[model samples]
Target: MRRRTLIRGAAAVVLVPAGLAAATSAAASPRQKSAQADDLVGVDVSNYQVGFDYARAANEGLDFVVAKAGGCQLSEGPYTSDSYAGHVDGARAAGLRVGHYFLTGDFLSPREAADYFVDNLHDYRSGDVLALDVEVLDDSTRLWNDAEVSTWFNRVRERVGAYVPWFYISTSALRSADWSRTIASGARLWAASWGANDGSYPGPPDLGGSYPDWAAHQYSSMGSVAGTSPIDLDLARPWAFDVSGPTDPPGGLPKTSAEQDGVPGPTMWKRTQNWLRIQSGYTGPIDGVPGPNTYAALQRNMAGNWGYTGPIDGNPGPMTWSAVQRLAAQHGYTGPIDGVMGPNSWRGFSRFINADAWD
Candidate 1:
C-alpha cells in the first residue's frame, strides 16, 4: 500500500534565477518567424504570484496555465504550493487549459517525491499536463541522476493511469545530463531556455543534441501577461496536450486462430516487420527477428497517435507496450491502459499485425 503524507504550508522554494526580472520591462511579442500562428501561448506560476487573475489572462488570449503543485525542498523537506489549488480552479473556471508541475529536489527518494507530488495535486484531471521540474539553483552539490529521474517518471506513471509525465529542464542542464534512460521511459520534454532574456518568443532552442523534439518551449521568463508580470511564457504544440481520442482508426485483419493463441512467434514478427517496412519507413530485413531497428520503427509509427514519445532506441519498455495497448483498444482489447501486457493485449496486437498485405 502507498503511504500518504500531509502537506505543510502554502509557500515553496522557487528556483528561477534573479537575473530574469531584469527583462520584465520588455514587450511580450514573438520576435522570430518560427513562432507558428497555431502555437498555444501560456504561463507558468507559483506561490510568488498570488491572487493571479486567471479570467483576465484568459480574456487576454492566454491558452493555458501551468501552476506549481508542490516540491520537496532541501531545507523544508516536503511542502505544497499555497496557491496551487486556487490557480487550478481559477484557470478551469476561466476556460483555460490547466497543468501542474512539481519542483523536484534530492531531499527524498524519487518514488517518495513522486508520491508526495501526486498526493498534493488534488485538481488533476485525466488530460491535465503533469510535469517534473528538474533544476538546481543553490550551492547544493546533489543533482538527480538519470536513474532517479526515470524512477520518478515510472512511479508517477504507475499512479496516473494514461497520462505520460513531462520532463522539465533547462537547456544547459539538459545538455549536461545523460538522460537516455529517462527518454526511454516515455517522458516528454518541456525545455526551458530564455534566449536574449527578452519578453519575446525566440523559438525553440537548438536542444544541443539532447532529444529529437520538444513538446513545449519556454521562450521567455520575463513575459508580461494580463494578470501576471514577468511570468514564464511558453509555446506548446497541440498534439502534446491533445486529450482527444486516437488520431487513426485500426486497419487490421480479422482475428484468427493465431491471434487467438495470444503468443508472438517468428511468423508474427515477420508480418510486423513487413508492416513496419511499408508504413513506418523501416529498412530492416523481414527475418522474423524483433531487433532494435524493428522496435525503433514501431516507436516512430506510434508516437503521434498512441503516446510513444520515448527515444527510438529500439529497447521496448512499459511505454512501448502501453502504446500497443492503446492501438489494441481499437481491435477489441478492453483492458486497462496500464503498461503491463497480457494475453488479451497480445491477441489485439496480433490482429493488427496479421493483415494480409503485410503477409
Candidate 2:
C-alpha cells in the first residue's frame, strides 16, 4: 500500500487504525485482550505511527499489513500517504501480504476520488486488494451515504479491472450512517469494531444489518501483538471468491483461497494448476475445473523426490494427502501425520500451489 495520485483542493480525514489519532491513544483503548497468536494478525498504519518497523511487526505474528495510500490535506491538496513508500517496501521484505486504502475527502466527487485511488494503487498487482475508508474523518466533512460510497467503489472497480475493493468502516459509523446500501452493494467488506482481546466480537459485522457476513473484522485498533504494540488487531475470514490481477512483489502468491471457492470444485483445481505452472512450468488452461490434462501435469510434478505413489489421476485421496503432507513437512510443518490439513498445513502446501499467497 503505497502512494496514489492526489486530488487537489479536496479535504480528507485519515483516522489512524482504531480511530486513534496517534500511538499514545493505543493505551486509551480498552485493556488488551488475550488471544491465540496463530489467529490471523494484521495492522493498519499511517504517518501517525512514525518510524514503523515492518520486520519487527511481522515477527510479532503479523500476517498482513494495510498502509494508508491516499488522503487529502487542506492546502496540500490530495497526496499519497507520507509513509506509503516505506511501508510497502518493508512489508514486502517481511514476507507479508499487503493491502491499500484511500481516505475519501469531503469536497471531491466520487469519480475523482476513485480515479485517484486507482492511480495510487496502479502499481499494485492482481494479488493486492484495494479498499476504501468510508467513514467521515473530519466532523465537518459531510458523511458519505451508502449510494455515494457505492459510486466511489464502482468507479474504482472500473479502473482496476476485476480486483474487488473492501470497505473499511467502523461498526458505529455503519449504524449511524445507515450504510445498508453500501454494505449490500459490495461483494466483500471489512468491519471495524474494537473491543477486549477475549475475541467476543461477532464473526462478521452486524449480520442482520446489510451484507450477509463480513470478510474481516477489526477487533482492536489499540491491540498489541507479540512483536508490535499500538497496532490494529483483526480477524479475516477466508474469502470464498477468486481474485486475480497484478500481484505485489510480482510472481508472489495470489490472494485466492480454497475456502473462498467453496467445497473445492473446478475453481480450486484452477488455482492448483496455476500454482503448478509457477513451480514446474505448467501450461494448462486456468479454468476452475480441470480435466485429464491437469492430472497429467500433476503427475509430472510428483516425479523424483516430490513423493506420490498414487496413479496419475487428478482425484486426490489418502495417498494424495499423504504426499501433500510430505511436501508440507518439507515446507516447515511438524504436525502429526494424521492426514489432517490445518492452517499450518495449508501454509506449507500453498507455497507449491501459489507463492503469492503462502500465508
Candidate 3:
C-alpha cells in the first residue's frame, strides 16, 4: 500500500481559525508567503441537528462530511439515526467527500454490534469512510474501557467492508482509556480536541491515543456554516483509504468454538442460544438448551426463508431439519436439503453465523 507524506510538528503552536484549516500556515507566514492548500474542511451531523444546507456548505468551501448514522443506547439498544440517509444524500448532492460514524457502547459484544452496524446501515459507496464515534461510555454507568474499545474496533475491522473506519473520540478520552493497540494498528483516528476556533491544526497535529497524527481533527463541536449555528466542523489532512488487501475469508463456524468439530456438546448448544437470541422472536435466556421456545423461533425464521411449513411446536422435526439444510444451502451448501446435516451444512452454518462462542 502507498502512504502519503504527512506533515510533522507533534503539537500545534495554537489553534487555527475556524472554517477551513488547510491554509493556516500560509496565513501565519511573516513574508506573506502563500501556503499550499494544505488541509480540507468538513462537518459532521446527526439526528440532533435540525437541518443542514449541503449545497450552501459546498459553496462555502467545505470539502467533506462525516455524518452520524447510528447510536448505541445502553438501555434502548442500537438504532439507526432518523436523518442519516437524508444527510448523506444531501451532502453528496452538494459534491462533498462523504463519510459516516456510529456511536458505540459497552453493553453488547463489540463484534456483534459491529456486525449489526454493517448489516443495517447503507452500503458504502465511493469516497465513503466509516467511523466509530465512541463518545459516551454510558449515560448512567461506566464509560467504555480499553478492552471494550479494542473489541469494538477490532470487530469493526472485519465488518467495515472496504471503507477504512476511523476512531472518533476526544483527546481526554484518548489519554484516559487503556487504549486498544489492536485498533491502533489498523484504524485511522479522528481526534476531538475542541476550542473556540478548532478548524485548523497547528503543531505536529499528532494525537496520542496510539497515533502519530490525527487523520482529522474536530476543532469545534459548535461550528457554523451555511447559517447553521452548531455543526461539528472538522479539519482534515488529505486522507487516502486503503480498501484492498487480504481479509480472512468469512464463514466456517456456527459459533466461535462450540465443543470442537462436529460433536454437539451442551457448551456448544449454549453458544448457539446466544447467537440465536439475535434472531426474530427469541425472548428467552441463553441457557444453552434447545428448548421449545428456541426451536420455535428457529423454525419460524427458517419457514418463510428456507422453505419449511411444519407446525411451530418447537419440535426439531423433519421440516426443521430441512430448513437448516436450506439455510446452509444459501450460505454454501450445494447438496440437497435432506434431513442429514453433513459437512457441507456445517461449513455453511459456520460461514453464515459462526463465532467461537456467543458473540
Candidate 4:
C-alpha cells in the first residue's frame, strides 16, 4: 500500500517504489494533454551551432529540442560548446519547445552535482524543460547510489516544478549503473534501445526499457531531421502544451495553500514560477526550486519593468502570485487573488503563458 501505482492505458501498471515517494511528492502538473506522438517530436543538440536557429528547422516540422547544459567536469577538458542560458534563449527564438540535460556520473557528489546544476541553470524561463543527462561510463568513482540519484532528481524536480518535464536517458551505460534499480521511477523514460526498426531491439531488453507512459524511444543513431545533422532517433510524438484549451492572459499571482484553504501550496508556487519565466524571458525548467537565476529573472521582470514585484527571493511567494493574477486579469482573466488557483486560474494563466505573446 505504501507503493504508488501508476496505471497506464488500461491494464498496464507502472509501480514507483516507496523509496521515491518523498522525492517526487509533487504530482505531474496538468499539461495541455496533447497526444504523446504529436508532442513526441524532439531532438538533442550538443555539437550544434552556438545559438539555436528556430527558423533553421521551421520547415522540417521540428516541434521540440533537448540540449546539453553541463555535468561533472572532466579532466580531459570542460565542454563549452553551449552555455545553459544561451540554449534556452536560442531555442525559444527559433520557435522550438526547449529542454536542458546534464551528463551524470561520479564527476561530483549528488548534492554538489545538484548545486552545480542549479547554479549553472538559474536563468531558465517558463516554457523549457530540464533533463539530467545521466549516461556516461568514465570514472565510476564519482557516481551516486540509487538513493542519492533519486534524491538529486527529486531536488531538481522540486526546484523546477511541472513546467519542465523530467526525462531519463535509458541506455547501456545508464542501465549498467548500480543506481539502475530506480532508473525509471518518477521520471519519464526516454529509451535509447538503438536497433533495427524492423522489429528487432539491439540494446538491453531488461533495462526497464518498457513503460506504457514511456514518452519516447531512440531507436537509431543513423537518422536525420530536415534542418539538423544526422543524429539519433526522433521523438515518437509532438510537443504538448501544459494546459488544455485556450489560456487567458496573465492574471493575479499565487497565495499560500494554508492561506487559500483548498488550494495546493505547490500548485500556487508552480504558477508563480511559471509566470516569472514567461515574463522574464526565461525558458528553463518550471520546477519550483527558485534558484539564483529564477530570482534574478523575477527581479528583472517585476512591476517596475513590466513585472509586479513578487517575492524578492528566488522562491515564489504571495507577491509574485499576486502579480501573475493581475497581469492575467489584463488579458480578460477575472479570477480572485486569493492565491488558490483552481481550473479557472490555470486556464487564465495558461493563455498568457502559452500565448502568441511570444510572437
The candidate maximizing lDDT is: 1
Clashing pairs in 1: 10-82
Model 4, residue 332: what's the lDDT? 55
TM-score of 1: 0.64
> What ranking emerges by lDDT with the best candidate at the front?
1, 3, 2, 4
1 versus 3: better TM-score goes to: 1
Where does candidate 1 have its weakest 10-residue lDDT segment? 1-10
The TM-score values for the models, in the order shown, are: 0.64, 0.55, 0.54, 0.48
Question: Candidate 1's residue-wise lDDT over 1-359, tens digit each?
Answer: 00112345524444555665667666474223233455687888876667888877877778888888877754557777777899899999999988998876757789999899888886789889888887763322456778988788778877876563677888788888777666645566788887786777665665654543476778777777774665778877655674322111245323244588887777778777665654444566766789999998788656634767677689999999898898887677899988898888988888766654454
Please provide, for model 4 over 15-57, each residue's C-alpha lDDT reduced to its tens digit, 9 standing for 90 to 100. Answer: 4333333323321211212222233455666544334455665
Q: Could you arrange the candidates by TM-score from highest to lowest?
A: 1, 2, 3, 4
For model 3, how many clashes? 20
lDDT of 2 by residue, 253-356 (tens): 34446443223445456667664442322455676666676765555345312455566556666666666666667656678666566676666665444433
Off by over 4 Å in 4: 1-39, 48-52, 76-84, 137-145, 171-185, 197-212, 236-359
Model 2 residue runs over 4 Å out of place are 1-39, 73-76, 176-187, 196-204, 226-228, 240-359
Off by over 4 Å in 1: 1-22, 29-34, 138-140, 243-359
